[model samples]
Target: MSSDESQQRRGSYVPIDFTPEVSKQCLKQVEFYFSEFNFPYDKFLRMTAEKNDGWVPIGTIATFNRMKKFRPVEKVVEALRTSKILAVSEDGENVKRIEPLDLEGTKNARHERNKRTVAVMNFPHENVTNMTELQEKMEEFFGKLAQINQVRLRRERGRKFNGTVIVEFKDLPECEKFLKTYSGEDAETLSFEGRKLDVFTKKQFDLQREATRGKNFSGSGQKARSFTGHRKNMPQQEQKDENKEEQKEETSKEEETKVEDKD
Candidate 1:
């Protein structure tokens, strides 16, 4: 045979073999199934060999078969008796015999942890020229949220006008409920001063250092004091004037009586 032809045949007949990385991956999959079924390492190896069609199984079929056999009513009971399966129970009632590495509570935990919270929303597109109008619109929008305990609204004046609103709820759950209801709705979209409404959490407000700005200081703080002081002084001044008038009437009556007696 020619040298070139010999080289070609040798190259074509190279034997296919699993690399070290592929072998490691197969072993890892086997270990994963073993842990999932809470089966002991020795029994897991046996089951893997039996169910894999003798091809060094590494896939869903092996895992599924292991899970099926290790269920509560299946071979899991025998495994537990022999101390080959790890048995976990909730509240000492229902024992779950499976691998500790299995993600049994993952779905429920993810759902609960993904909940959202209520936050302040800025409406910059709606033509709210004054603070009163901005506050009125905010109250109108938030009135739908029955869970909202209080709302403090304010407006900032600068080159770009912006409004800030604070919404306080009874608890975190209520806040989360509100967010779920209104987070992605068309009616919740607000506009003021040519800017769209921006919603953010209380934490975000604190981070941006916008919490104390644009407060309702005049209405919330000194207005009540001024009204009360005016009311107090008004009653006392009216009483003094009334007493003076009464004294003049009494003196005039006495003088008229004396003149009549003289006559």
Candidate 2:
């Protein structure tokens, strides 16, 4: 192309020609989006893992004591439809459904959350206290997170919040997800009711490791060095005496060898 044509193309907007194969591929791609998803699909809806981003070890998810059961998207959606909780499209390219929070009184269900735990803070003083009310409020605010397992919210030791929350999850992944999505200074921040929250994460660490880790010793400072640069620390006469002793031992060993040869 000429420089003029190239210049014209550089700043121009071009659209792809929609060939029949391209059109079919586009339709297939859109269908795939509705059919696939990652972890934490609802038990009430049907799910399919026909195409998935990753996998969990077979027993890793099931062996847990309190995790919500997961199923293929196909099964989950079918159940949801039977219960009037799911909606979809004729071409299978769209989905709509009511989450657990949209259901009446699900916030108070007794299902367990994750084994891991994370804390959150900066809730408004109203409807929060160190009690069940605070737990309910937190459960209501976090939506599906509150429903999948047990959500434990404990009130902090100050009057700043009616519900300063210490959130506990059933596993580390859940705790991590909660922290990543909600905690931080960024705004249009996540909120509860109408009030925005200052979110905080409660981290867990083991601090009671033994003094020697697993070894066997107890002392304040480190022991002496194995290698040194200088012999300047030695008394000159003492060093000579030690060297003489070593030489004497070598001479005696040589004499013994000579005597053995004679024998």
lDDT score of residue 240 within candidate 1:
32
Tens-digit per-residue lDDT, 76-186, candidate 1: 322223333333232222222343433435423322322332344444424545443444466566766656544544333331223455665646787766655555444
How many backbone clashes does every candidate have? 7, 25
The worst-scoring run of ten residues by lDDT in candidate 2 lies at 218-227
Q: Candidate 1, TM-score vs. the true structure?
A: 0.28
Model 1 residue runs over 4 Å out of place are 1-118, 125-127, 157-161, 182-196, 210-263
Candidate 2 positional error at 29, Å? 45
lDDT of each: 0.37, 0.34
In terms of lDDT, the poorest run of 10 residues in model 1 is: 254-263
Candidate 2: tens digits of C-alpha lDDT, residues 160-255 = 242334455546676666667765444236666665554443321001111122431111112111001231222333222545544542332232
